[model samples]
Target: MTVRIVTDSTCDLPRELVERYGIIVVPLTVIFGEEALLDGVDIDAEQFYRRLAASKVLPRTSQPSVEQFAAAYRQAFQAGADAVLSIHISSKLSGTLNAARIAAAEVAAEAGRQIELLDSKNVSLGLGAVVLAAAERAVTGADLASVLAVATATIDAVHVVCVVDTLEYLQRGGRIGRARSMLGTLLNVKPLIHVEDGEVAPFDRVRTRARALERLAEFVREHRGASRLFVACAGNDGETEAFIERVRPDLPGTEIIRGHIGPIVGVYTGPNTLGVCPVMPV
Candidate 1:
C-alpha cells in the first residue's frame, strides 16, 4: 500500500525535504491588520518580520478550514495514494486537527479510502522531526499502520525547548496555556519553555540570554542519543549560527539540521527566538 504523509505548515520541515519526501503541507492563515495571508505561501519569514516591526497592530493566526483539508485529501487520493497519515500540530494549540479530523471522516465515508490522523503534540522542528521520520518510513513502502506507529512513537519520544526573547508575543497570541504564570515576571527573566502534552510549559528561567543559551546546549547534551537534532532561529542569523556551534560539542558527531522558525511560528514566538529540538528513538 502507498502511504502518504500529510502535515500542516507548523511542522517547519525544510522546503527541500518537503519536496524530496513528497510531504504535503497544508498552510495556516496569518492575519496582519486587514490582510489574511497563508502561512508559507502568501507570506514568508522576511516579509512577516518586516511588517511586524513596522505595524502597530499585532498579527493574528487562524487555522485552515475543513474544505481546505478535504481538498488536500482528495488530491492525494487522486494521485494514487492508498492511505494518508494526516499528522498535525497539537490540537490544544489550534483547531487545525479538528478540521483535519472532520475532513478525514468525510473522505472515509464518501470515498471509502483510509485517512488516519496523528497529532504531534508539538510545534516547529519538534513537529518537523516526526513528519520527516514518518515520511521516511512511508517512502520505504511501509503500510499505513506501520507509518502511523512510527509517527505516534516519534510524538512520544520527541523533545523541544525554546527560549523566546520576550513572553509578550506568546501572551498576545494567547498560546501561553500552562505557561501563563511565566508572565508574572516576564520583564525580569528569559523563559525556557517546552511544549508538553500539546500545551506550552515553563522549563526554566534564566536571568540572561547567555545563561539561557547554556541551558539549551545542556538540554541537547542530555539527549545526545536522539535519532536527529535540529536548531531553529527566528531570523537571528548570527545568534542561530553561534548557538549551533555551542551546541555542536554536545551532539558529538551528530549532524544538526539548520532551519528557520518561519512566519507562522514567528508570529507567536517573535524574532530572536532560538530553539533546540531532539527526535529520540521510539
Candidate 2:
C-alpha cells in the first residue's frame, strides 16, 4: 500500500522539497481587513510581506477548512493510495488540526478509507522537520504507524527560538500585549521566545540584539546536545549571516539548513527576525 503524506502551509518546508517528496500542502488563509488570501497559493512570501508592510490594518490568519482537507484526501485516495498521514501545525496555536481531524473522519466514512492525522505541536521549520522526516521514512516503505512514530518522535525533540525586530506585529497578533510591547520598545529590549507545544511563548529577555543571539546559541548549546540545526531569517540577511558565522565554530559537525521565514510566520514576526530550530536525535 502506498503511503501519502500531507501537511498544512505553515510547515514552511521549501516548495522544491514538498514537490520532491510529493507532500501535499493545504494553505491557510491570511486576512487583511476584508481581503482574504491563501497563505502560499494566492500570495507568495515576498508579496505577502510587501502587503503586510503597506496595509493600514493588522493581518490575521486562519486554518484551512474541512472541505479543503476532504478534497485533498479524496484526490490521494482516488489515485490508489491505501493510507494518508496528514500532519499539521499545533492545535494549541490554531484550529488546523481539528479541521483535519473532522475532514479525515468524514472522508473515512464516505469512502471507507483510513487517514491518520498527527498534530505537530510546532510551527514553521519545527513542523517542517517532522513532516520531512516522516515523508522520508514513508518512501522507504514504512507503514502508517511507523511513519507516525517517526514524526511524533521528531516533533517532541524539536525546539525553536525566535527574535523579532519589532513587537508591534506580535502585539497585533495577540502574542504580546500593548504594555509589554511598549516596555520592550522603551527599554530597547529584545524578547527571546520559544515554541512550547506549538505555541509561541516568552522564554527570556535581553537588552541588545547581540545578547539575544548569544542567548539563543547558549540555549541550543545547552539543550541540543547532539542534533541537526535549521536557521531561519526574516528580512535581514546580515543578521542571519552573522549568526551562521558565529555558530559555525561551536557546532563542529552539525548539519545546517538556512532559509527565510515565509508569510504566515513573517506576518507575526515582522522583518529583521532571526530564528533557530534544532531537531534532537530521537
Q: Considering every candidate listed, which one attains the maximal lDDT?
A: 1
Candidate 1 global TM-score: 0.97
- Model 2 quality (TM-score): 0.91
Off by over 4 Å in 2: 176-186, 223-225
* lDDT score, candidate 2, position 117: 92
| Alpha-carbon lDDT, every model | 0.88, 0.82
- Candidate 2, residue 173: Cα displacement in angstroms equals 1.4
Worst 10 residues of 2 by lDDT: 177-186
The best candidate by TM-score is 1
lDDT of 2 by residue, 153-236 (tens): 998888888887667787777655323524434367888777875677777788888888899888767754546788887767
Residues 1-282, model 1: lDDT tens digits:
898888999988889999999998999999988889998899877788888888898899999999999988988898889999999989888889999999999987787889999888998988999999899999999899899988888888888899988988888898888888878886769899999998889999999999999898889989988768988888787988988887777776676888888888888899889988887778
* Clash pairs, model 1 backbone: none
